[model samples]
Target chain A: MIDVQHLTKRYGRVTAVDDVSFRVEKGEILGFLGPNGAGKTTTMRVLTGYMPPTEGRALVAGHDILEAPLEAKRRTGYLPETPPLYPEMTVRDYLMFVATINGLASAERRRRVETAMERTRVADMASRHCGKLSKGYRQRVGLAQAILHNPDVLILDEPTAGLDPKQIHETRDLIKSLGGDHTVILSTHILPEVAQTCSRVVIINKGRVVAIDTPENLTARLRGAETMFVQVDSAGADATPVIAAVPGVTGVTIAARRDEQASYEVASERGHDIRRQLAAAIVTQGWGLLELRPLRMSLEEIFLQLTTEENAGGAEVPRA
Target chain B: MRNVLAIARRELRSSFASPVAYVAVGLFALVFGYFFYATLVFFAERSLQATQFGMGGPMNVNQMMIRPLMLNVSVIVLFFLPMLTMRAFAEEKRSGTFELLLTRPLTDWQIVTGKFLGAMAMYSLMLLVSLVSILLLFLLGNPEWRQVATSYLGLLLMGGCFVALGLFFSSLTRSQLVAGVLTFSALLLLWVINWTADSAGPVMRAVVQALSITDHFDDFSRGVVDTRHLVYYLSFIGFGLFLTARAIDSERWKG
Candidate 1:
């Protein structure tokens, strides 16, 4: 478990993390979504006990990060933005060294290091020097190092940043698997990663926490207009007019068309659910209602909306 | 202690993995070997001359040969020991491994002391080179072995002071070159402080001479382990390590 209360970090004249507070329950994967220079790394640094916060405090596994930093650090694993690999050390030796410093028993170190290497999928390059590893491998090796000791908490900054699409997928799966065993706080600018892997999302911008919620709720909460996708088999006839005839239908546009089947994106009132009405109307008009589904706003759109609103307002704005 | 040893091992391994160790030890051995042979030949000639003239009995080997040899070694170490510690903290900071280290469960003292030991290990290898020449002196001639041992202890203590000072400088910057230059400048200043003492006021002269890093070694090489000199070298080392810890601690607040 991890708890951060009123955390603030400043570097001279610039405040990197401003009065941000959040809690991560045991076995939960919290996605930290933020743009570059948004204090994501700074917050992670504070949580990992790499540095003390300028104000407030953080607790990891029930230990305060500042007052009992060693205890907190002992229970937490950190993957900095840079991988922190020694160029001269072989990957195995590097992980072994990390294991030692993390306070693993001598007997546990070898097994843990091997397991970490295998889990991060860097086993094949075990003997290669870290300096010779590719960017993706370097990031994986960094991850391997973080989880090597099997710490209770893992703070990963941009864990999937340098990986290719396939590697990203594998990493996300690995992180998802790590959930329910290790509390994870991973920061990234990638929106889909949060939507796909995280149980909850924290959107941070300009040193402030803009929004925090589940990806689904974040998308649904920001949805002002209810939109639906309707595919109608019109049999050579246009079905747009008939759909428009339905009450509460504010607008309709053909999203795509293929031969006798066409899909229309229909917008209705914010609180309206016109699926039943639209489906019945199409059926009564002797048209086949093939498919109907609601389209929630994507996390990408919601993130942009929240961050831009926070930037434009630059003051506390009421949120529902 | 295990934590300290682990970090120390990493430092030593990294130094050996790079060309720095080879280059440093190579240059030190070359210079020290030259010093050894020159001192040996000079002492051998003087001893032969004294015996040939029947001016006195055999020249005292410890005074005439081994003491000067150890003195020259301490001077050569001043030139080379900085290379061993120049990268101790600076390289870790530059490579972002400082994050890895500071975030670990180890305390700042453990990290600092570990690095100190690592540099000392490298320094010991250079000292070992000088030892080989001293051993060759024993194999071929007679010298006070106890005096040689004390001289080595002196060199070890003096090297510890240099190493700790270099670590403090390295902690202040992310540039190895800057660390090396600052350490050399500081060591050189202390090395010559005794020479500068002659021009100072009488009261100031004693303090300046006592402060010279080399001045303490004179007693050790002469086969004396004066606790006064012991306290000075130790306090010098302790102060350097203490400052390094403070520098590392202040980084958190600044960040």
Candidate 2:
């Protein structure tokens, strides 16, 4: 439901968002991952019709963001980096105001506001002023406003930036529940959030979309070899030589030792299952196998590898 | 129009929710009451002097009291209008609500008009407070009601222009203090522009004098509702609001 084509935004001498392009299908939760100052917020801002891009165009629900801003804006709800709130207004009044401005009918406005408040769990604080609420409540109130109108597209920037761990978990669950109905584009520097909540991830670095894929696919593609951590009771007999002697074993390195047990990180060729052969070899050497587990790359590792590796190679390739 | 009203309603509600509206209106009433009392005393003293000299004619309260009070209120608004409008766009930008406002389906003109009307609504309340003092004159004295109404019209129009100008300045900055200071300076400059008329040549003098906001207001305060003066105030308001609309439009590009 969202299409961005070669969108570029420049602030005088500095280009905040370079020529970047991406598309998000209906009901897709696209995680916008980037380091600080990676233009994630800028891209979302352009798509929300908050600011026009310096070059190219963006479409929301089949309407041009620049040419038909009102139509585009009508179908999109945006929660900026900092929640856009009026400190003087109560949570109820603020949401009602948002509902009114969003052009909801009077009869529908009250129901929508109540539903939003209930969903975000701000119903108890509805009468309390926004300024008096804690950071987590404020964030929830912000989410309520964005989802009140039930727009077709939702663009959130750092939705869980200042929340505590529990709040973050609740927010991620809320966002996950919002999928399959509202097309979501959320930006964050948090890697696990993408893995847990988003269906697809777009990793941007230095104002460019360096990598875009599912979290699982990204980790799978980046892992050139399968790795496993194995701990054994060496009994004064080293197991590295025996494990490395297996047919598919690529390499092995001593990891750590506890009492008489030593851990070895074993590497094998991709798509190879060397655990059976390696276990047989260890048994033949009279070494007791204590623990054996495959080491899958975490989203953190995949993110770091993708972002830093691109920077190291100085690749600024413009997406076609 | 519905969107405009919604925005205006929200703005008005938020204004009253804070101390800014109360403080501004309270200060206005205090200053206006003091000026009204001072001007009434001076008119009474002058009338008494005329009676003692056996040259007393009928005392025209509209001419002696209402006219001067209206002018005084205009001057008071020159200082207080910025307080009403400085937060119009400045606070929104500071608190990041400007993004929320612009990202909505409402147009720039709707936002500008809504904010302008909201500020004007508060200003009207300030004027209404002064009306209580004016009503007392009608009850106790035989002031010409037509002239009193005309003076109020003049105040309203002048206040509209002031609000428009203030809103324009507010849109240009994120600092409310800077917006207020800049608006006050701009109004003061316009208020004193007529002072330079004497030093300039005849043609230049006319241009400078015409630009003075108070000069156009003088006709309405005198119970003379000339279309020319009405046109001038309307044009002034239009120009100010037009500039404010343009200022907001530029924000889209600058962002």
Top candidate (lDDT): 1
- Candidate 2 regions exceeding 4 Å error are A311-320, B56-58
Clash count, candidate 1:
0
For model 1, how does the per-residue alpha-carbon lDDT over B3-115 read when each residue is reduced to its tens digit? 99998999989988899889988888889889889998998798789978987785888998888988888988999988888898898899999999999998999999999
**Clash pairs detected, candidate 1:** none
Model 1 ranges with Cα > 4 A deviation: A228-245, A251-266, A275-295, A311-320, B52-58
Q: What DockQ was computed for model 2?
A: 0.88
- TM-scores, all models, native as reference: 0.92, 0.97
Per prediction, the TM-score for chain B is 0.97, 0.97
Per candidate, the number of residue pairs that clash is 0, 0
Candidate 1's error at B136, in angstroms?
1.2
Q: Which predicted model would earn the best TM-score?
A: 2
